[model samples]
Target chain A: MPDDNNPIPHWQRQDLPPMLSRRFEFETYSETRRFLDGVAELAEAAQHYPNLSFGKTYVSVTLDADGKKVGPDLVALAQQIDSLVAGTP
Target chain B: MPDDNNPIPHWQRQDLPPMLSRRFEFETYSETRRFLDGVAELAEAAQHYPNLSFGKTYVSVTLDADGKKVGPDLVALAQQIDSLVAGTP
Candidate 1:
């Protein structure tokens, strides 16, 4: 888990809806599928789900704080998922 | 399956990226999850994948024709998924 104080820099912060969003590129569909599987696992464990959308070679993610202003916890979870995605082959 | 010539009206069409995108709103996390499950099944059946993202009460979807111009096939798939999502409780 990443420190809540320091959010991942790669994720673009958005305020229109108070969320953090990013798109992860992949080399193949299989790789993208694996990354999504990791995200599913993370969602199940944390009970904090992010909107995850993927194409043949990319996965786009958006994290919202469930009606609250986007907070550190959401950022940290995004960072955690980023790590999980990076860890995927 | 819907007619290939006619697509769903609610889905907004975009040409910059050659894709069709829509966001579906739900009343609960469980509803969102169920909608996602239906989407997964649709993906498996069509062998066509869409970028699908969901927050606590909404699911956003984008469908691309896999490097080709957004065609009837992609639009049809989106329409198909739209029906599946609408069917979810």
Candidate 2:
């Protein structure tokens, strides 16, 4: 998990953006869309959308502050998405 | 609307690929994500997902048969997405 006081862990950092990024794999398009649905819900509720790219079996989600300083809400959003994928929330 | 027997209409054809592509604009991130949620549902129900790209105020959806011959499902999926955006269903 990522928090404000420490450097984001490698497992959590996308390391390529001023944003948090991650890729998720699915067994089928249906499964992938299910996950994307969760992301869409999370983003809408928070009013903080991510850049989403997806295909038959994979999804790549990228969230950037668009040149602003990264904030806790973004980190929390990433965690929420991860939890959604894990099926625990 | 795109169909099986005719060239896809200019109003409907994305014009850039062996795929159908289009961009949607939103007034806010929340609105964009709401649209994306609809797309996710449509894709999941049909088992055909689009390549989705989005940001704060815009979304771009691209769908390809992925080198397979374009089929009715693909065309139908695109229309459903459009209608979903239009809030008709």
Candidate 3:
């Protein structure tokens, strides 16, 4: 069941791999690069790094669970990542 | 036929999408981040951006062809990327 009030609704949850992932699209490579840089800084500050893949206009981010289940910390991290482009134009 | 003297022998050529791709592994996330920055600089300088995907210790890069085949320019770009880690400890 999907939560209607999920803070990071765009992110998909995986069970077998115990991961949460999302793909963000941008209007240009510059925007994509900016988002990536923001994620890097956030990861550095939180000490929680995620797998990131990007092309000219999109970035795919995967957050792995340290334990068997996706915990609150991971969810909070995802919310922070979502905030990177939350109100951007 | 494989070119024994190919400058970017590590990069694999794909026909369907007309792309040249390669994966580079690093000893640490810091090294991976450095290589990624170098690639970004090279792409900006050459105006030829490649698809980049990375985790904590590896980066996968893909260069797409503008036409039917991977051209010399793409090969040159791959060579430059390879140089970013060549002969380094």
- Superposition error at B6 for model 3 (Å): 1.3
lDDT of 2 by residue, B1-89 (tens): 35666533322454345688878888876687688778877877887767878787888888877776667878878777778666522
lDDT of 1 at A10: 74
Which candidate's DockQ is highest?
3
Model 2 iRMSD vs. native: 1.7
The top-ranked prediction according to lDDT is 3
Model 1 residue B44 lDDT score: 72
- Kindly report which residue pairs in candidate 3 clash with one another: none
For residues A1-89, write the lDDT of model 2, one tens digit per residue. Answer: 45667533422454345777778888877687688778878887887778878887888888886676678888788778888766532
Tens digits of per-residue lDDT for model 1, B20-57? 88888988877877887788778777888878766778
The CAPRI-style docking tier of model 1 reads: medium
Clashing pairs in 1: A51-B54, A53-B52, A54-B51
Best by TM-score: 3
**TM-score value, chain A, candidate 2:** 0.77
Which portions of model 2 show Cα errors greater than 4 Å?
A: A1-17, A28-31, A44-46, A71-73, A86-89, B1-17, B28-34, B44-46, B69-73, B85-89
